[model samples]
Target chain A: MSGRSHDIPEEVQVLAGEYVLGALDEAEMLAVRRRAAADPELAAAIAAWERRLAPLADAVPPVAPPDELWARIAAAVAPVPQEAAERPPLHAPAEPLVPWARPVRPPPRRIWPWQLATAASLALAAGLAAFALLPRPVPPVEMAALTPPDAAAPGFLVTARPDGSVVLTAAAPAPVPAGRDMELWVLPKGASAPASLGVLPASGMRMVLPTPPAPGTQIMVSLEPKGGSPTGKPTGPVLYAGTFGALSP
Target chain B: MADARTADEPTALLRQVAAGDRVAFRRLYDLQAPRLYAVALRITRQGPLAADAVHDAFLQVWRNAGRFDAARGPAEAWLLGLVRYRALDIARRGGREVSADDLDLPEPADDGPDALEVLAGSRDAAALHACLRQLEAERRRLVLLAFVDGLSHSEVAERVGMPLGTVKSWIRRSLQSLRLCLEGAA
Candidate 1:
């Protein structure tokens, strides 16, 4: 910050700090995120900032979560039945969650540091790809289907153009109550607020987003009052949502 | 050896988690969930949303634990970062039905140690806190508002009754000063 560490530009340092601090607006946040994927220096600066400021989190007092919370997490992370047969039982924890007090024992031999390094590097590579950080040319047109959780068929198809305009087409007339209107919202990656893209007409509509959302950004529709959310944010239930790049035929 | 192992507890657990060790995953959950929940709660300002953030973050930990690079940062920070990002996302989305139970929850305490004092309390953070203390009180508070409370630049400016441009400039300068001071101390 003061003296550039590692010759990182002052702009990059400030941007990293702002990104870590969650200060950048949606557009700026997305730009920083995109830059960090391919920019090792920028990523390192961000990591360094995260390390320096992380300890300050100790000041936030701990609060006990609901008793049911653990069970919910355990169930959510539990392997599918087929996968469960191949691994240890997730539910019954005979061993303590924290083995810190137990007498020292030889380390588990299954995973070695080198092996972990390999996995970490592979994961990092995969992460870069998943974030669409590759330097490949941008696809002119991208699309995703927004589907309800219970329904297999996509309720809406979102066609996003390079110009940051999105066309939302509903498969069926959207089921809106007499006085309610459905609104479209884009939750850009790393952005603090979901920017409203305006209300959706029953059949289909096209609108321009301030910027095209990144691949992992969430697109959602919430049922609002007769008009879109009175406050700039979504007020009603998120009736449908999907990741931007996760297209379905 | 025991002390060293204890220090590496979270890291070891994370490695096990990467290998599909559910027991270690649960243990790690037991160890870190409360602290993470507190972080989520602070940022989202809603209990249900906080719970959702922690829940989602832990699932990411379970699935992507292999991606954790020890050399990049501490295991705890890696974990906290996940929840913080999730909480921020939920907060930004804005309106969801507030759960009836959340209505009875106590509001977060506004008066606590300022950023410097909070950092000063921890051994790891003490030096960083000292660096932070070197900044003017107002600039330091701006840093705290942005980081801890998860307020955006405009929100911080509004709270402090300053122009947005002035607030942004002050925060940048303050961060640079902290970084410089910490580097000198090191």
Candidate 2:
């Protein structure tokens, strides 16, 4: 930011340029986006570039999409009807509607180098004084970074203690809309369903779990209705997820 | 395009889409999907992924159409941005990067001055097309390949056979110059 070029900084200009040219990977894009959101000048620069380069799209030849493509899009975008606060169904449901979704491994995520770099910058900046506050990682104290599959930036970092307690800390949390809350879920090995691990603390929180999870257990955060998902299962898309692993040596 | 509606129809259709008008949404998809799909296809190089990008983009447009203020830019530009982001993401998620040489499709025949001006109908598009024409040939090609084909800085450097630093500088300069030209033209 110091020793700037003209009025705006050179690195920011480069960021806006990279964003427009699509030269940046997700991690860089995310970093620029976080900045542009707060800085109007950067946003204006980006918008101008988007407008200027938009015409280049004319050169691309239009190809017809598949016949059923519209159907798929329509189904995906249909608004989820709001639940009635007071009125129960006229007829009692025959059974509980707990959907048994197979917790399939999500597509391999693209963790951009810059995203890792951002997190590493934080850890390095903290140095020893910060490390003094953090618990020592012993044989049973494992940590994991929970990054959502669709995320462009960093995600939450969690350190699990051998005594079934965990400290969940937010790195770059995915934004949740108003009237919505982020719910954490744990899918332990050999479990048929994901157990609710309470809401993710905005900053960071330490909570004792009923049992210590095994290594390699997957952790997920989903955007649920206000409070949490009405159903026991995830009613919304899983925004961020990552598996548990040993702390960095 | 098939219906001979004015260029403004896309903006109108998007407004309707925001209101949950399914039929209007269908027409919007019919009108714009091909171009969006083509953009995605160019970047993803796979039919399924390209289709997914388009589908995801349209859904995003439907959900966020209300946020589209025509005053910002054209509907086509807005929609194209969505699809372009989606396509780039798909390419990255699949760990698939296609160099210029690896592409099997023929390059856009009009990779020169007035490449975009001929099709431009809006003042912004026309201004941009003119500004692009002012850039040097190599810088323009770099911009096109990077934006259109969704190549990264390193990929563009390898494709253009230039050093990475040179590519970055040219792109940064090209962007600044283009912004200046467009503003002056306006």
Candidate 3:
């Protein structure tokens, strides 16, 4: 269906709103889902609705869950095969059925953002060093860096860095439908609105925003239509969001 | 009863969970599970189903703990989102739907004007409770059905024995009114 120029249709907005409120029926919900996949405008509207009505979920009081529930779930989604195989045997009791009798111990510390960023930098430097020792071919000058959220693996990179300018280089390729683009978002601390950096390619291509965002700010990428976010702020699930720790001179 | 430590916030506990701290996850579960379970029970109505939903939700918490982004919303909202989605998914699967008769919640104590006065001890929570009291009986029922029972429009209509259209409009208007009432109280 054809959409109006420069504005989302009122009916679409209402539908999106209801969908966010969980008021729509199963059929209506499916229709919204299909449209959201194809239409960026509808997706943005639905995201806005999700944010507004999210607070209502907090109105209900909490209840404690049964003990066996967590264990059942843990058994289902355990990451490693060896871990999964070892789980039941580890938990199976030899004598008494009193599972709560065993003393509990804490798990290991998680990988912090700083640690992940440092690791990525080291890996990048190592790769560059390997390249430097091998070929005499001229290296590309301008580079753009795409860092994922702290502690997350670097999903993409930027190759063309010119003083303040940068280009997005996809580390791992992502699928993008025709006529759609990935818009970058710069979310500063204490700022509600995410600033649009520019549109990026699904694979890897070059597009530069006004300039690199302020240091220590979170850089995010969300899928948007050709021109970018109409609302001037992100209205999509953050695909890649990370901070800029240091820029190479 | 273990004295709940107020020093560590939910975010801190979540961070610990992200680091693979199972004990911290258990502590976090203890701190927040009661309210989340209450929500699930209210929505699912059947105790076992609610328990199942809560179980899945916390397991999601454990597995996807690393995905917790503090910038989007609070730890409680994130956790509650998981529960709300799970409860709705269960309701959609046609396990057991909450009926209005199933939701015969005790009427707020009618201490007349002194109700608000007595609630002053916990002003914020009291304000919310008072505003909830201000809603018309039917509207309050609708809110409870939507928030607790996780009933969609048609389900609410079925429970209340009202026309689906009427139930939908009532819920929308009631939510708007409640938002205004709570804002005014604040």
Candidate 4:
């Protein structure tokens, strides 16, 4: 361990202490979070504050949570099933190809006026094919609903289009700190790296996010200390999560 | 059944909770809930929210039991931190923002003697509580904020209307003083 000056600066220690106590404003809070992610020393300092202050819980009397709360939390935390396993099997007609069939050959012909017209039509078709191969914009589609894990309830509705733009409208209000921000994450099944959609507005009403991943991706909300995750992945507890399944064509 | 032995040491119970022992967690809860609840209730001054704070705090302890480091602090401090953080989080969310004027310090209860009395029969707890009592008023408040209200130094500053710098210095000096006091007692 480094000396108080070198290992953990006294100023940063104080900042970490304040952070653990919930004292910094939104901006200072964000700076501390970023520092904590990069600096293990600062994190340890904050953790120390957590330990020192943890004993004060002795002041309050304990009350059991409602029986339904645990069940609700468990349901929310449950993992969502992926598509390959859940999709219905498709039954389609199959065509058989023959190996011994004779190949048809066209007769050698002169270039006539009608043949010239036919050549022009073929050239036009090739040009159209080239045009089709070029990149084009995909239109956005409205995201209908986000289904919670275990099919317990629809927690939020997302409206998004092909342009990579999305809007998250919470069907129910979520508890969020006044100075802190809620962050949205897309947790693909079995994936450890949760893609951050963006910061969620605390109002629990409506907020727009950058382009989301394709449908059937699991969406999660975490109570970030402030700004957003200093690390790209979630470092806080996930508050709510649901999967956005594909809508019928 | 023969005379049941009181599981005197908290560390043993904490070890069980760490191992996913629900029965142990319940016992731990039964052991610590009163004090934890009192802490939350004092800060928030709302019964239902205080209950929520306790629930959230215990749930966190259940989930993060493996993260406990005995070298950093005792089991009681760690659990208190959980409840305090949860209560502070609730406070920041504006669940119930009671001003200092609104604080109603309950009279010391006379319910068949207090926790200190029961623990005084034991050596370690008695020594620890005695050491804690030796801290100055400001330092004691800081400890309470950290353990009971779950207020970070910044939150403490906001609640007390002091500058962040002053609050930070107070907490550090207070901790240092408490450490010295505990060492002397030990």
Best by lDDT: 1
Weakest lDDT window of 10 consecutive positions for candidate 2 chain A: A98-107
Candidate 4 lDDT score relative to the true structure? 0.52
For residue B6, model 2's alpha carbon misses the true position, in angstroms, by 2.3
**Model 4 lDDT tens row, A70-142:** 2222222222245423545221112121111111111122111112223323433343323323333222233
Candidate 2, overall lDDT? Answer: 0.66
Listed in order, each prediction's TM-score against the native is: 0.61, 0.56, 0.46, 0.44
lDDT by residue for model 1 over A1-249, one digit each (tens)?
Answer: 425474988788888998888777666777888999999889888888888889878878788865435544654454334543465521232222210111112222212112222322343223332333223333445687788777667888777644334667777545799999888776765555665656676676665442344566688888888867777677898888888767722
What's the CA error at residue A114 for candidate 1, in Å?
A: 44
Q: Give, for candidate 3 chain A, the lowest lDDT window spanning 10 residues.
A: A98-107
Task: Write one digit per residue (lDDT tens) for candidate 4, span B67-126.
Answer: 777776677767766765566655655545432333334533422124334444555455
* Tens-place lDDT digits, model 2, residues A1-249: 212224766566667878977998777777878988999878766765666677777777788865435544553444333442233532232222211111122212222112222332333223422332234322434687777775566477777643334667678886679898888777654454676655564665565442334455667888888877777578898987777654456
As for DockQ, the candidate ahead, 1 or 4, is 1
User: Scored by Cα lDDT, where does model 1 land?
Assistant: 0.69
Give the better candidate number (2 or 3) by TM-score: 2
The DockQ figures for the candidates are: 0.29, 0.25, 0.13, 0.12
Q: Candidate 3: where are CA atoms >4 Å away?
A: A1-22, A28-63, A77-79, A82-249, B1-8, B97-135, B178-186
For candidate 2, give the lDDT of residue A243. Answer: 71
Ordered from best to worst TM-score, the candidate numbers read 1, 2, 3, 4
Better-scoring candidate (lDDT), 2 or 3: 2
Native interface contact recovery, all models? 0.58, 0.60, 0.31, 0.30
- Measured over all alpha carbons after superposition, the RMSD of each candidate to the real structure, in angstroms, is 16.5, 18.7, 22.6, 24.0
Candidate 2 deviant stretches above 4 angstroms? A1-14, A79-249, B1-5, B98-124
Interface RMSD of each: 13.4, 11.5, 14.0, 22.1
Would candidate 1 be rated incorrect, acceptable, medium or high by CAPRI criteria?
A: acceptable
